[model samples]
Target: QQQVRQSPQSLTVWEGGTTVLTCSYEDSTFNYFPWYQQFPGEGPALLISILSVSDKKEDGRFTTFFNKREKKLSLHIIDSQPGDSATYFCAASMSNYNVLYFGSGTKLTVEP
Candidate 1:
């Protein structure tokens, strides 16, 4: 069974607008949340991450808001741009485990 889940299978936004992707997990043991961005024909790259102890994390235009109590989180992309269009994946893993459970990615398109 998949422990991580993402919503809105796909999304489209205009340049300069912001987009939000929601994710949830079933495993309470998962404490580390990482968001990855993938471009066509390329492997996913680590975008940003947050620990269970953190309520929020931000890096430049990307931010992740986590709710440990609810085992849910959301990634926000600010100042959306055409170059930012890609498949965004939210993943979770246990502190001691190397395996990461990834949610169904949200394909985002930033139209100019």
Candidate 2:
């Protein structure tokens, strides 16, 4: 009942375009939200994320829109660029201190 599914194994965009990534889960009990961004051969870093109680979260050029009732969420990359090219993973947990169950991740590439 605690599974997160991601889509678009990979995607490409322009240097200054937009990129959208998605994630879905079955468990509504999972409240913690943490999106991680990973570069090639590197570990993921904590990106912007939203709690189940909130509808949105943003940091810099990244944003996360969450729909708790739907058990779904998405990440929108504004002004996507080559530096933003990385693997984005969606994860959830019951609490911030708990371990997060991460999605396989969506590979995004922004060409200049």
Which stretches of model 2 miss by more than 4 angstroms? none
Assess the local accuracy of residue 27 in candidate 1 as a C-alpha lDDT between 0 and 100.
90
Would you list the C-alpha lDDT of every candidate in the order shown?
Answer: 0.95, 0.89
Query: Backbone clashes per model, in order?
Result: 0, 0
- Superposition error at 1 for model 1 (Å): 1.0
Model 2 Cα lDDT, one tens digit per residue, 4-109:
9998889999988989999999877899778899998888999887888899988888889999888889999999989888999999888746778999899899
Candidate 2 has a TM-score of 0.93
Q: List the residue pairs that clash in candidate 1.
A: none
Q: Model 2, 14: alpha-carbon shift in Å?
A: 0.7
For all predicted structures, in order, the TM-scores are 0.98, 0.93
lDDT of 1 by residue, 58-105 (tens): 999999999988889999999999999999999999999999999999
